[model samples]
Target: MTTHYLLNKLRQENPLVHSITNQVVSNDVANSLLAIGASPMMAMAPEEMEEVTKFAKAVVLNIGTLTTEILEAMLIVGKAANKKGVPVILDPVGVGATQFRQEAVSMLLKEVTIQLITGNAGEMAYLAGIDWSSKGVDAGEGKASGREIAERVARRYQTVAAVSGKEDFVSDGRMTIGILNGDPMLTRVTGTGCMLSGICGAYLAVGGKPVLESTVEACTAYGVAAEIAVENKEVNGPGSFRASLIDALYNLSEQTIRDKENIKRYHVNKSEEGTNE
Candidate 1:
């Protein structure tokens, strides 16, 4: 696929992405979207949620700071996006942490028609209704491979699934892709996963592409930026690396993203054992 072509289209379109995300990562998400040449609008008011998503290119619903109020708003906005034919990206943060968290994720799945669900392996497994070792939002361990969990969840939800980790895996049931381009430093930073969800929102906004390809493009672009950010000699720690990550996103060229991304595409069947596609 011509991934960088989509990157260029995103830059040119600069689509408006409506995100109902956590307050903790609001600035990070907003600034990262700005750097990537996409507009970010963070609106969580129940009264305005549906209105804002009416014309938005994409809607992002995150459960990082899940509350009953936000949950209701997410449902309203998700329906609005569906009505408008706008794509919705759902981030099931901490789905394996507590009963409340699990219930909240369950409610979302039952209500909204999510186009993409992005999280770690534990979160993906939880969404797939399988057992996975987890505490808080971070993953502990899982019997299934990230690809297997992602594929299962995608089929179960009938939505694209992206399991982010050292090796990010994205699947839309029929096809799965492994992206090996990010930096380990991404783990040390808080809300980076949230930021990645934001990136996915940005790309999904500029539609006219398959959900799997759009998601893979977003992950690859974000991963390339992270890789370049850590390579900088001055970025010696998480804080600096985080800041450099934004700058790197702004300066990244479409040519570089196409040439440097390490992507492995796979075709998955009912058994979930994938073959190189």
Candidate 2:
């Protein structure tokens, strides 16, 4: 299926997304999902995790502000979603900053079957067991390229991995697709990456394409929205850009995605590991 076809299906289905994300960007995450025609349920109570997972078409687990209670809720919700055959998307925010965060990610990966993982280059590098210099939540300098990290992470976790940066790359242990569509202003806004994770969950919930295609679609759509948001003359800075971004998502069209998306496909061969763009 085509990327626009999956996007149109997501809008038509309006799937429910259960997000166990940090408090800092919960509002943005919810609003972004709603803007893309998905119902967002920011429910974190461990007591009701199973029930909420039962009703959710997709689950997003973000570890931006990690806590014991929040971690517990994520585990419960992730496992429940797994049992129901629902897609689970993980955003390991600031994972390399602390040992606790690293351990938390390891635990979650051990117990939960994540369908897709969305994070910056540094985060994906850490998950792939590569040596990367991470500065808090930002994607610090890394020796390995984003494509390498994404492919390694996908192979290690047995799922789709997406690394977002100036250019976005999504891999499924076989092929990696690079998307060049977003703007630099996206980095100025808080929770933009988190919001993209929520969007990935929504696309996966629609379930018309493979996990890799769904993730690429999510990244492309999000990047296109950011590019459109920054094109408005009214957007001067982060505040205006953030507001305009939501409007862009709300008004996003399949034709726009088709016309503006800049994507390149690369085949990943185990014997000869090199990018063939």
lDDT by residue (1-277, candidate 2, tens digit) is 2457877888898999999887899999999999999999998889999999878999999999989999999999999999999999999999999999999999999999999999999999999889999899999998999998999888888889999999899998898999999999999998999999999999999997899998989999999999999999999999999999999999999999999989999998876343222
Q: Best by lDDT, which number?
A: 2
Taking the tens digit of each residue's C-alpha lDDT, what string does model 1 give over 132-230? 888788877978898888888888888899999889999988889999989999999989999999999999988878989889989999999999999
lDDT of 2: 0.92
Measured on C-alpha atoms, candidate 1 has an lDDT of: 0.88
Write down the worst ten-residue block by lDDT for model 2. Answer: 268-277
Residue 123 local lDDT, model 2? 92
lDDT on C-alpha atoms for all candidate structures: 0.88, 0.92
Clashing pairs in 2: none
